[model samples]
Target: MSAPQYLVILGMLVNVSFALAAHGTARTGRNNARDNLVAVAALAACLWWGGFFG
Candidate 1:
């Protein structure tokens, strides 16, 4: 309902999208640990920002 919440939600959406994209990429014979790590890092950043800054 507030700005922080909205941003958090958006961040979560982005992380989810990235995960889906990574999954697709992996299925297409492009699976890589580096890509997966990036996605996980994004999710971690989102959670950290939302939890601390909010």
Candidate 2:
């Protein structure tokens, strides 16, 4: 796959990971989930652009 395709997949995974982390936090009402959703999302939206700004 090309770089754009890779970015798309990475962005998708980042979104899913974010949602998973959010749901887990909501499930327990605390910041206990061990994940880096923000960093991953930043990489997709900023570094990769996820095919939207590239």
Candidate 3:
């Protein structure tokens, strides 16, 4: 894949890892919205960069 595709892939990985971390932390009563927001933002960026508009 090209650079942009690779970046999107990386972003997906980031979102997944962050979500897992957030879930784990939630189980310990240490989770927060900010963590989930960051993942959402990354997913948005990835989708935008992936050309959802096109």
Q: What Cα-based lDDT does every candidate model obtain?
A: 0.66, 0.61, 0.68
Candidate whose TM-score is highest: 3
* Model 3 misplaced stretches (Cα beyond 4 Å): 1-26
* TM-score result, candidate 2: 0.44
* Model 1 lDDT, full chain set: 0.66
Model 2 over residues 1-54: C-alpha lDDT tens digits? Answer: 577767777776877666666754545465532445665566567755544545
- Per-residue lDDT for 38 in model 2? 62
Alpha-carbon runs more than 4 Å astray in model 1: 24-54
Give per-residue CA lDDT, model 1, range 3-54, as digits (tens). Answer: 8767766776676677666664546486565575676677768777777545
Cand. 1 TM to true fold: 0.45
TM-score of each: 0.45, 0.44, 0.45
* Pairs of colliding residues, candidate 2: none
For model 3, residues 1-54, the per-residue Cα lDDT tens digits are 477767766776786677667764646477665677676777778777878534
Q: Pick the candidate with the highest lDDT.
A: 3
Better of 1 and 2 by TM-score: 1
The per-prediction tally of clashing pairs is: 0, 0, 0
Candidate 2 yields a Cα-based lDDT of 0.61
